[model samples]
Each structure stands twice: as structure tokens, then as C-alpha cells.
Target: EAGVAQSPRYKIIEKRQSVAFWCNPISGHATLYWYQQILGQGPKLLIQFQNNGVVDDSQLPKDRFSAERLKGVDSTLKIQPAKLEDSAVYLCASSLEGGYGYTFGSGTRLTVV
Candidate 1:
């Protein structure tokens, strides 16, 4: 199976700066998710999409974080005016709808100085 693809595996930005991460999920997968993993902490669900429609975003910080899956394929996540606490790895994952297995991308690491 082709793995999910993410770009710019690492990033560093001063506080209040903005950054964006891109993700391309495996083909045929209908569900996609974005997660935030703080250092030494388990990944937290940021958002989830079924096709082009959002299934869940209750954990997303809409004030500064936003995401979209374009036409139900590739996706992007953006964080504006990043805070020091936002430093972490942003991961993208995808799976078949209602499937148990999830394939995850390598992730983009953000450091807010």
C-alpha cells in the first residue's frame, strides 16, 4: 500500500507566526484525520473528514487552526499566529470508512519559538 505523504517534515517559526502542512492520503480511503502530538503525549484528534465533509472537529481550535480536504482527496492544515504551546508533530492519517486500520503519514514537526 502506498503510504500517506506529508511535506516539510520539520518546521520552526517564532511565536505568532503562521505555518501550513499538507497531506496526501492513500487512494480509496474515505476517511481522513489530523492529529496533534505534543512532546511525550499521545496524539490528539484535531479534525476528521469523511470524504469532503467534516465528521468531527470538536477538538479543533477554530480560532487559529483550520483544515480542509479538497474534493475528498488531498488535505491541508494551517495554524495562524502560532503559540509556544503549539510546538509539536502534526500527523495525517486515513482509513476506509468504518475500517479499523489507519495509515499515518510521517508528520510535520512545528517548533514555535
Candidate 2:
């Protein structure tokens, strides 16, 4: 089966600019997640969505970050007025259940200049 898909594998943005990342999960998977990974650090869950509704977003920086899963399939994550500190790899993952059998994308590497 195909794994999760993510676009623009790499991105370069200026500080204060906005960027959006898209994701398409494996067929039939019901749980999706967005994670941020800084170099040398483990990926941190930014948000989790079950179908079209959000399940967890406790670590998301609500003021500048946002995400949505549409129709229980595709999802998008956006960061507006991005800061230099936001330069990191953004990962998209999907699972059949909340915390098991996760399939992650190659990741979108954002370089804030």
C-alpha cells in the first residue's frame, strides 16, 4: 500500500511570510497527524485529527499555525508570518488507529531565510 504523501519536499521562505504544506494519507486510514522536527530533536506532535475533526492540538502554536483535515482524507498545515525558529522539517503521518501503525511522509523541510 502507498504511504502518506507530502508536497514541496523542500521550501524556502522569508521571515514573516506564510507557507502551506499539503498531505494525502493512505487509503482507509482514519487518523492523521502533523509533527514538527528540529534538527537533532525528536518529532513533536503538533496536531492530530480524526476524520474532519481535530483530536489534539495541545502543542500547536495556535497564534501562527493551523491545520485541517478535509472529508477525512487530505490534510493541510499552514504557518503564517513564519519565524526563523520555525525552520524545521514538517512531517505528516496517518494511522488506522490513534497511536498505532503510523505511516509518515518523507517530510517537508522548511528553511526560513
Candidate 3:
């Protein structure tokens, strides 16, 4: 199966700066997700989108993190005033409507100093 696509495979920024990551999901996939993965830990789901609407974003940090999937095919995740603790890889994924096996991108590694 074809996989999700992500841009700027790596990024480095200072604390209190901002960064953004982009993703393009597989064709015909209705469910899209953004996950954060810190070193030594599992990926944490940050947001979910079904079609062009938000399905869940409870885990997203509203004060500094935001995401959008405007057309249901591409998405973006942004972090503003990034914190040192925010250094991690951001993964984008997608699946069929049932939430089963997901196709993930290569991920964007963000390093905050």
C-alpha cells in the first residue's frame, strides 16, 4: 500500500520559536491522524480527522499546537512558541474509516533547543 507523505523530514528550532509540518494522506482514505513521538516513548495521538472535519483533538495543546485538514486529503500541524519539551518526531497517518491498520509517513523530527 502507498504510504502517507510528509515534508521537511527534519527541523530544528529554538525554544519559543515556531514550526510547521505538512502531510498528504493516501488517496481515498477518510481518516487522518497526527501523532507526536518523543524519544523512548510511544507515539501519542494529537489529533484525528474524518473527511474534512475534526474527529478528535482533545490531546492537542491548544495554547501552542494546532492542526487542520481542510480538504480531507492534506493536513498540517503547527507549533508556536515551541518548548524544549516539544522536541520530538511528528507522524502523519491515515486509514480507512474503521480505524484499523494505518499508513504512516516518514515523520518530521523537530529539535528544540
Most lDDT-accurate candidate: 2
| Per-residue alpha-carbon lDDT of candidate 3 for residues 1-113, written as tens digits (9 for 90 to 100) | 56899999999999999999999999999999999999999999999999989989999999999999888789999999899999999999999874899989999999999
Of candidate 1, the 10-residue stretch with the lowest lDDT total is: 95-104
> Could you tell me how far off, in angstroms, the CA of residue 95 lies in candidate 3 after the best superposition?
0.4
- Candidates sorted by lDDT, best first: 2, 1, 3
lDDT of 2 by residue, 1-113 (tens): 89899998999999999999999999999999999999999999999999999999999999999998878899999999899999999999999999997999999999999
Best-first order by TM-score: 2, 1, 3
Whole-model alpha-carbon lDDT for candidate 1: 0.94
Model 3, runs deviating above 4 Å: none
Q: Which pairs of residues collide in candidate 3?
A: none
- Pick the winner on lDDT between candidates 2 and 3: 2
Question: What overall lDDT, based on C-alpha atoms, would model 2 receive against the true structure?
Answer: 0.96
Error of 2 at 14 (Å): 0.3
